[model samples]
Target: MTRIASCQCGQLSLTVEGEPALVSACNCTRCQKRSGSAFALSSRWNSNQVRDRSGKGLTYSRKGASGGNVLFEFCPVCGSTVSTSLELLPDVIGIPVGCFADPAFPAPKVAAWCESKLEWVRFPDGLLLLRDQTQPMDTR
Candidate 1:
C-alpha cells in the first residue's frame, strides 16, 4: 500500500510505500519539545520505501537523547515537522504518524524514553516500553 503524508500547509509531501517496519512513541525531552506534545509518534521505513518526495523544506539537525544525530525535515511555510532521519539508523526515514491523519493507522507498538513519559500518559497494554534508547527494540 502507498500512503501520502504532507505538511500542514501542503508545502511538503512524502509518499511512503508499504507498511512501516516499526512504529514508535518517543517521550524524550527533545521529542516532547519538538512536537509540543507529551510524545511524538513515528513510523520507520527504509529509504527505498519512500518516494515522490516533493516541495522544499528546511532541515534541523540535533543531538538525539542517545547522542546520535537526528535530522528533522519541516515545511518552512507552516513550520510543521514532516519527517526525520536518524544517524543511528542509517538509510531509514521516520515519518510523523500524525501527518497521515489516518485514524485507522496502526498504533505505536514501542515506547521509547519511558522514564520521561508524563505521569498522566498511559500506554496501551502489552506495549514494549524502554526506559531509554539503550534497550533493545522489538521490531518484530
Candidate 2:
C-alpha cells in the first residue's frame, strides 16, 4: 500500500510506499507547538520508502528530546510542517499522521514524553506510555 501526506495548502507532499515501521505520539512541548495540539502523532518509515517528495519547503532544526538534532521541513506558503528527520535515525523519515487526513489511519502504538502530557489527555488502552523519549522507537 501507498500513502500521500500533504501540507495544509497542498504545496508540500510526500509519497510513501508500504506500511510504516512504527506509529507514535509525543507530548513534548515542541510537539505541542508543532501540532497546535496536546500532542503530535507521527509515523516512521524507512527513508527508502519515500518514493517522491514535491514542492519547496523551509527547514527548521531543533534539539529533540533525545538530545539529537531534528530537521523539520514545512510548507512556506501554508506554514504547515510536512515531514521531519532525526539525526539519531538517519534512515528514517517522520510524517505527521494528520497530514494524511485519513480517519482510518493507524493510531499511535506508543506515547512518549508522558511527563509533559496534558493533565486531561488520555491514550487508548494498550498504548505504551513512556515518560521520556529515551526508549527505542522500534520497540513495538
Candidate 3:
C-alpha cells in the first residue's frame, strides 16, 4: 500500500509505496524556520517512489556545509515546508514527517546536527542522539 500525505493547506501532496529509510529531527536555524519549531521532524524516502500528486512544489535553495546546494521544497499556497534534497543526492528525498495522516508515527531513531539545538527542545526520550552526523548508532 502507498503512504500518502499532504501539506496543511492541501496545496501539495505526495504518495510513496513504502516507509522512509530513516527519520530525524533537524535543529539548524534554517530547519527551524522551515518547520516553524525548534526542530524539524523528517523522514527519508526514495526519490523514485515519491509522487507529486497536487502538482510540483515551490522551493528555496542555498549552499550547504557540504559545499553543495540544499533545496527546500514547500507548499506554494500555504508556505508549509515539505521536503529537502541535497544537490549531490538527487535520488534521495527528506520529507517532513508531520505531513503524515498518522499522528503517531514512531519517534526519530537518531538526530543530526544537534549542536545547533535550542535549549528548550526535547528530543525523543532515551533515543540515540547526535551532536553531528558522526555520532555512532546501535552496537555497530
Candidate 4:
C-alpha cells in the first residue's frame, strides 16, 4: 500500500509504500538538533517505495561519524525535514512520524541512540532502546 505524504507547505511531496520497517524515536544530539524537540519519531520503509511529486525537494547530506552518508529530505517552502535516507541502510528510508498527517497513528517501536538519551527523558513501554544503532535488542 502506498501512502502520500507532504511537507507542511505542501510544496514538496512524496509517496511511500506499506507499513514502516521500524518505527522508533531518536534522542541523539543530531536528531535533537534537527528536530528541536525531546526526540524525533521515524518510520523506516523501503526506498523503492518512495515517489517524489514536485521533483524539487531539498536535501542536506553529511558524513556520519559512524561512516556512510546521511541525507535529509525536506521542503524548501516550509523548511520541514520530511524524510531521510542513509547509505548504510540502503533498503530503508526514514520518515518523520509527525508528518503522517494522521495523529492517531501508532508510536515508535524502538528508541535509537539511547546512549545519547538525556538523563530525564522517558521512553514508551514495550519499546526497544539502543545505545547505538548497532546495539542488540534488549528484551528487558
lDDT (C-alpha, whole model) for all candidates: 0.91, 0.91, 0.77, 0.80
Ranking by TM-score: 1, 2, 4, 3
Model 4 alpha-carbon drift over 4 Å, by segment: 136-140
lDDT of 2 by residue, 26-107 (tens): 9999999989999999999999999999999999999987889999999999999989999999999999999999898888
- Which run of 10 residues does model 4 get worst, by summed lDDT? 131-140
Per-residue lDDT over 1-140 for candidate 3, one digit per residue giving the tens place of the 0 to 100 score = 57777788887888877778888887777778767788888888889878656656889999876578999888888887777898988899887888886776767888777778897766656667676665643422
- The lDDT ranking, best first, is 2, 1, 4, 3
**Model 2 Cα RMSD, 1 decimal:** 3.2
Extract clashing residue pairs from model 2.
Answer: none
Flag clash pairs in model 3: none
lDDT of 2 at 10: 95
Error at 70, model 3, angstroms: 1.0
lDDT of 1: 0.91
Q: Which stretches of candidate 3 lie over 4 Å from their true place?
A: 136-140
Stretches of model 2 off by over 4 angstroms after superposition: 135-140
Q: Where does the lowest 10-residue lDDT sum fall in candidate 2?
A: 131-140
TM-score of each: 0.94, 0.94, 0.85, 0.87
Off by over 4 Å in 1: 136-140
Encode model 4's per-residue lDDT on 34-57: one tens digit a residue: 998988888888777776555467
Candidate 1, residues 57-92, lDDT tens digits: the string is 999999887888999999999999999998989999
